[model samples]
Target: MISHHLLLCATPAKALCCPDPAAGQASWDSLKRLVREWGLEDPARPEGIVLRTKADCLRICAEGPVLLIWPEGIVYGGVSAERVERILREHVIGGTPIDAWIVKRLPFRPAAA
Candidate 1:
């Protein structure tokens, strides 16, 4: 099972689910780079490795640029490139999420293999 599940909304312009598509794209890009740099993108990566993907919409329209991390279910809003970096360092790798940036937090559940 993956250690972390990252869902980022990279919706098209004018979409209600995301207000700032540019920021989402940046966050997506940052996440990709950070994951690989952290050695979490290997095909044979360990069970507690991160898996990230770009999503069409995350259903949190008001804040735009939404990012969700699971199985902790720490949902963050208004994500940008800068925020992505800290999240990768502090949350994904360090095991402590940035509470201020978090918009929602759901019960933690281990990912099914």
Candidate 2:
């Protein structure tokens, strides 16, 4: 089963996404490519699979291409295709969060008992 989830914005509201809409699309494509390249999306992959999803809008679209790493709720902005690999390598696989590119963040909240 998949343990990690990344939701990237696919749509923009009021042209809020940084630079242009293509940036978000680029992130979506780069994210998928990197995940596949790292074997995170393979069906036969080991435990802790990461699933990448595309969303219409994140509302925090001004500084975006926003990417939300779920369960941990790490939100990153300005995630262009150029930054995907570093984000994946440093943050996703290495268990370290990248602070410089972050737009906003929330502590990973667990389900209530």
lDDT per residue, candidate 1, 1-113, as tens digits? 57888998866455775766677778888888889887887667755678898877666665768888887878898888889889988998888999999987777566699
Candidate 1 clash pair list: none
Off by over 4 Å in 1: 12-14, 43-47, 108-113
| Superposed Cα deviation of residue 44, candidate 2 (Å) | 3.5
Error of 1 at 5 (Å): 0.6
In order, candidate lDDTs are: 0.80, 0.81
lDDT of 1 at 95: 89
Query: Model 2 over residues 1-113: C-alpha lDDT tens digits?
Result: 87679988855555666557788778788899899988887778766789888876777766787888876888898888888889889888888889999888877667799
Q: For model 2, state the Cα shift of residue 102 in Å.
A: 1.2
Residue 16 error, candidate 2, Å: 1.9
**Candidate 2's C-alpha lDDT?**
0.81
Per-model TM-score versus the true fold: 0.82, 0.85
lDDT of 1: 0.80
